[model samples]
Each structure stands twice: as structure tokens, then as C-alpha cells.
Target: MVIALPDPPLLEPRVLGVEDFATKRGRKYGTVLVNAESHGVVDLLPGREKELVAS
Candidate 1:
């Protein structure tokens, strides 16, 4: 018999660190959102407008 383990729950961050940078060609922009407590990258948004990053 085989048993499957349940997936771990996701962590919710109270504080987020956001960073924005441009591609080498300067044609696209990328944004990174990190969890302050864990210091882990939570999300990455590429080729997105500045407004989206701010929001």
C-alpha cells in the first residue's frame, strides 16, 4: 500500500520587500517581492509596468 503526504501550508507575510530592476537590454522591467521575515523571494513579476509594481 502507498500513502501520499499532504502538501504544506503556505506562509502569509505581514511585511514584504519589493525591488525593481530593468533587463540588460532595458526593454523590459522586473519586480521581485520578498518576505521580510524569511528573506525569501515570494513572487516575481516580469515585463510589467511600473504602476503594477507600485500597487
Candidate 2:
């Protein structure tokens, strides 16, 4: 049987906060940036380097 699903609603764009945590896959380490206000991710940066602040 085929099931039809409704499309998800779009989120309004606004100022987003970026955060990082410890992540490892096998022997690799990385960081992930996520939005503070909304339920979304901004980007994924390589290594556990310091995060830059944007004005």
C-alpha cells in the first residue's frame, strides 16, 4: 500500500548560534555546529579546533 504524507512546514530564518561537541568515528575526531534557537544544524567542521565568532 502506498502512503501519502504531507510536506513539512518551513522555518523562519533568524540569528543562529553555533556549538560543538566531541564526536568520534573509529579514530577520527570532529566537531558539529548546531543552531541554538531552531532545531537545525549549521555546519560540520573538521577537527576539534577553536570556533570562530562572527559579528
Candidate 3:
């Protein structure tokens, strides 16, 4: 049997942290969103493309 867990809820924040880091080191990159106020991780994106970050 297999089980999956739901992701944590995201709430409106006064301070947010957005960071893009290289995965494969220059070959690939990803984005990370954090709720800076509570110092909790919000979400991670597959790529750090400019269009992806804008939305």
C-alpha cells in the first residue's frame, strides 16, 4: 500500500522570500518560495524561467 500527504497551506504574508538556485549548476535551475514571516517553505518550481517567476 502507498500513501501520500497533502502540501501545507499557503497564507497571505507581509514578507516573502523568493530564490532561484542552480540544480545541475548552470545546466538547470529551480525556484523556491518561502513565507519569510514564519520562516516556512511555501513551494518549489521546476524551472526558474522568467515567465514562470512573473506569475
Candidate 4:
């Protein structure tokens, strides 16, 4: 069974923190968006698409 998670709330991060991490060694990767000011997690995006994150 597939469970769909609701999309994270849209936030205008005052201080954006962008980072990339490996999900599987030499296989897959994902990006994490954070609010640098509040130190809160904004969103976790799957995949390594440069354009997606650039925007």
C-alpha cells in the first residue's frame, strides 16, 4: 500500500540553508532545506536535480 504524505508548508525562509546528502552510498541523494535563523527544517527533497534546487 502506498501512503501519500502531505506537502510541506510553503515558507519564505529568512535565512535559507541548503544542503545535499547521500541517501545510499554512490546510488542516491537528497537535499535538505532549512531555516538558518530559526534552525527549523523546511523541506526534504528527493533527487539531485540542480535546476530544482536552484529555483
Candidate 1 structure quality by residue, lDDT tens digits, 1-55: 2357675577899999988888988878888999999898889987467677776
In candidate 2, what are the lDDT values of residues 1-55, reduced to their tens digit? Answer: 2357665675654766555456454455556666667757666766665533331
Runs off by more than 4 Å, candidate 2 = 1-26, 51-55
lDDT of model number 4: 0.83
TM-score of each: 0.66, 0.43, 0.69, 0.69
The predictions' CA RMSDs to the true structure, in order, are: 3.8, 5.1, 3.8, 5.9
Assess the local accuracy of residue 24 in candidate 2 as a C-alpha lDDT between 0 and 100: 50
Q: Tell me the deviation in Å of residue 35 in model 1.
A: 0.2
Candidate 2, after superposition: displacement of residue 37 in Å? 0.8
For all candidates in order, the CA lDDT equals 0.83, 0.58, 0.83, 0.83
Output the worst ten-in-a-row residue range by lDDT, candidate 1: 1-10
Better of 2 and 3 by TM-score: 3
Q: After superposition, how far is residue 41 of candidate 3 from its true place, in Å?
A: 0.8
Residue-wise lDDT of candidate 3 within 1-55, one digit each (tens)? 2347675675787887999999676899899989888988778888998789778
